[model samples]
Target: MTHQTADATDHPTVAALVARSNRLGGDPRNTNYAGGNTSAKGTAPDPVTGQDIELLWVKGSGGDLGTLQPKGLAVLRLDRMRALADVYPGLDREDEMVAAFDYCLHGKGGAAPSIDTAMHGLVDAPHVDHLHPDSGIALATAADGEALTREIFGDQVVWVPWRRPGFQLGLDIAAIKAKNPQAIGCILGGHGITAWGDTSEECEERSLDIIRRAEDFIVSRAASRDAHPFGPQRPGYEPLPDDERRARAAALAPVIRGLASFDAPQVGHFTDSSVVLDFLARERLLPLAELGTSCPDHFLRTKVKPLVVDVPTSATVEETVTALRAAHAAYRADYAAYYERGAAAARARGEEPPAMRGADPTIVLVPGVGMFSYGRNKQTARVAGEFYVNAINVMRGAETISTYAPIAEDEKFRIEYWALEEAKLQRMPAPKPLAMRVALVTGAASGIGKAIATRLAAEGACVVVADLDLAKATAAAAELGSADVAIGIAMDVSSEAAVQAGLREAVLAFGGVDLVVNNAGLSLSRSLFETTEADWDLQHNVMAKGSFLVSREAARVLVDQGLGGDIVYISSKNSVFAGPNNIAYSATKADQAHQVRLLAAELGEHGIRVNGVNPDGVVRGSGIFASGWGANRAAVYGVPEEKLGEFYAQRTLLKREVLPENVAAAVFALCSSDFSHTTGLHVPVDAGVAAAFLR
Candidate 1:
């Protein structure tokens, strides 16, 4: 990686471009300089670009992007790039410039495109970027980067071996893009790649995505092979002195936020608990999992790693967390101290953290100590920090074989920062294949929603009941409790935050999230004219918008877990076939059905299936259904309670008003592996209302 050279007149611009390249801001941050180069080819197109969709301008290569000048940007005719790709099907390092040139860039109008132009010309994105980041390098070193990439990103991204730069890489980009018109880019293993998007920001976002994925993969591998810390399966803990507990919490709180995640309460509680304390204090409770981060993208979900600390019972949670609170800050302070101390200690010593200093730490395994990471996002924190408690145990058994040594810091950083490597993270949005195996149900209270949730739970899923009625969700959970069954969450589906919070807790509790039943809904029997707007909104908010919020978050978790998921919308027959003069009740349910269809397409690649069920009038009694059918029908049709069943049932071919339990059965079917491929379609519970009517 030598520095770029520049012509005298282009010195200033070249310097600026060189600086930009070296800053290492976006994708390929830590591992770039050779993957891809930017060269502005010609002037802007005649049309003005729209907002949020800027024409991310790239200067063509005069010298190189590493030291490109405004003039260095060839502004060449893009036509050449396009033509070149079409002509050169077998481009490679040996291809002559003119011979490969025709095969690389083509004429858009009559203009000659840049040599690396095919990539810039053909991509259908607003922004196109090419980089070789550091993390990619680390990932590639293991020789399993490709498999790992496919596992995490699904089918959105493409991974290719390193090809020679210039025309060869350019042709490869065009070929891949032609086949996957919707593709972002591909990883150029040893070389680099060219990526495109609808906009520059989008391009940057995609770049970030690639690096993160690569980082996550490599880190995971490093952790798996190396033995650093050995911790227990269950965190060991015991009561700690109050002073120590509070002290630990206070000390670790801020660092935890930066390195673990937002859930301070859970972290503090877990750390302070007797179980965790005992585990941390145990001399042998080394790193359980030397968690290498998935990638910088995972940074958003998991900080770096957990501080797997082992402390004596005397060391309260507060004391330990609190004491460690100053650790990060102290570390930062120490970096400066080390830098200054080095000035006095020795000039040759690198003044930086061990990680940055080119010293690959197999994590500092303090015998009785717990694990930790550099940032928040605790999920990753635990992964990053746990020095593979497993590795520790294995090593203990293998002490006779040989001691372990962490990879070198420079190598680690090289892998961490490589660009050609990070492109894997920027892959497309699709569901991982893993999520299909698991399912979760909530509001297993009773009636329609409960029936659906419970059904899934019974089908070998680790069912967890979540509802506003904690007792009810709990009772339902208890009744179904088994090897795979779990507990209940007292959540009010009506509240946006509550639903999200509950679902998140479930995701963390369970390793992943797959099926979500947006089944908790209520129907008020007030007639059309009598319903207030507020009442209508309340109903819609829960039945419609609530589902929206829940499905959105659920999809994210599902995608992250690299597993497919399912969402079942429980509707009423009233949604499609008009029921009386009722407006609010029917309208909201209809909205629910529509929403399901739309989300199905959006989440399809993620393998998240969305479907709807329109159950008929469910018979109710004095229990959870006290107000189930309160008067709307009796008021409109002026029908007596005695003849309601006869009136409603007579309309159906089966002559039966669908029961709450029956609706639940439909929901259960829609959400399980039974309907793994079904989505975007709505099924009616009304026996033959629509089916019987050939008219």
Candidate 2:
């Protein structure tokens, strides 16, 4: 059969390829995020030669197909890529082939070529797609996968037995296609599915057809078997009520995350989604989870396997925490052993093993609550959870038809420590200083609090924008980034219940808090004679009492995590400097200033640092000012409301207004490693207030 190929002006060819990739990637049933590649073989004109040259445009390395753009496509000269076969070495040296892809670039390639480049270029088709759809992997990992492939699709789709992905595997698939001219795709044993077609439309349709058929086949097979593929729910492992389960998860997240961060600090994601809950409650949960995931994409993010917490749904949070601590220790030991075994095997085979990445499991499974996945950042943690869910689906489908069999342990190790993968990791950008740290900033909806949150997020910290106004806080969080980077929660810091609930939400959102900024407060300026009981109480309750409550609750979690943290109180210059008609506010500010020193002394044993930032009268963009404090302060100072900032600036030694960002910068500096050894310190952002300066 002759295939019509697109020529130089066929830009639509690549566009259609991208569109098809996005469609397939958009659905979880088709492929997990960043787990697949799509390519179109077309022709583009060589600028110098003015001749149409055959080229291959494939999804590049480390990119998600769902969000693929033209620039994310790696362009390669088809002829040069095909020529790689001439000097190709054996499987032992297959990794070298990746380097050769650079030499096959068509001009400056738009993006780096991925490991699967050969699989697409070598295949004799204009369009090809390699996907990790759950249903397809289910068929791939089944014990009788090859026979099932024949039985299900006859000759339309063939089975290619397991071979670690590389140049050889690509050659193997190409050979199979040559032999089976009628074949449109193949199920890669212990891996995934790859489909090819004469046209882009045909390729996408064929890929979807394979996935649909595989899913239907699993459903049909399951109809004759027990409804629960993973076995009936274990007697004591049923899911708790939604509220209780979440509360338990929130309580447990910090402990699990801290343990997971034994080697390096990690951000975490929690899920009580139906699939995760169902899997956790099953009788076969332990055995299947122990067997680990089959697909390389699944294990790379989730680690070889997850650490499962053995506890009943009715177990108390304290009891579960005890169990988790013990489980984590054992998991670390087992992981070390696994690494040694793999390293020994590599040495025997005359290949030096790569250094161990980390002993901590990236994923943790609790019988009653849910799964907690951890990584260097929130997105990685979330993706790891998603990949594990895909693995669970694969296991369920595989069990429906036949015994589920993942690749051998040694094989998993080989891929896990693959030199190419290590190189890819090395190429990643250095992490930001605050990466993996979670911060909860009260009053973060606006003003100095929002500025601090923004700065922390910019430095790579996961931020929880906590405020009494949930909507404004949420909006602020959204402006900062996605849920992985920031989340907003309603937090009335003055209320103990609200503070506890808000911190719980923060823990659930990003494992635990490493930084807490007590920036929530209201200001009241009144003469001693005119200050009412209500004014005094409101000021004290919101600032002095609020800071204490937030600090106390956050300290409990910080100590429980056993991870050192920082708590910075946003005080005021009036804390030290005597100011007229500011009795109530100044007293509360003094209370906050003292709390910092007191907590710093108490929490030092736990490595928790407490500090404070004092700013002079901030008028512009100040929430307190906007709410009427500016006019009150201006009147007391005998200056116009608009001149309040300038008035304060002129009085300062630096003669510069202290904006919200200036206060934010001081907060950041205090929480940063720069101030690691200097706690109980008050940094004034009030230009140069000699009276307020620390003596």
Model 1 ranges off by over 4 Å = 1-443, 482-484, 620-625, 628-630, 691-695
TM-score of every candidate relative to the true structure: 0.42, 0.98
The model with the greatest TM-score is: 2
Best-fitting candidate, measured by lDDT? 2
Reference-based lDDT, each prediction? 0.49, 0.92
Please identify model 2 stretches exceeding 4 Å from their true place: 1-10
Model 2, span 76-158: residue lDDT tens: 99999999999999888999999999999887788999999999999999999999999999999999999999999999999
RMSD of each: 20.6, 2.7
Q: How big is the positional error of residue 146 in model 1, measured in Å on the Cα after superposition?
A: 48
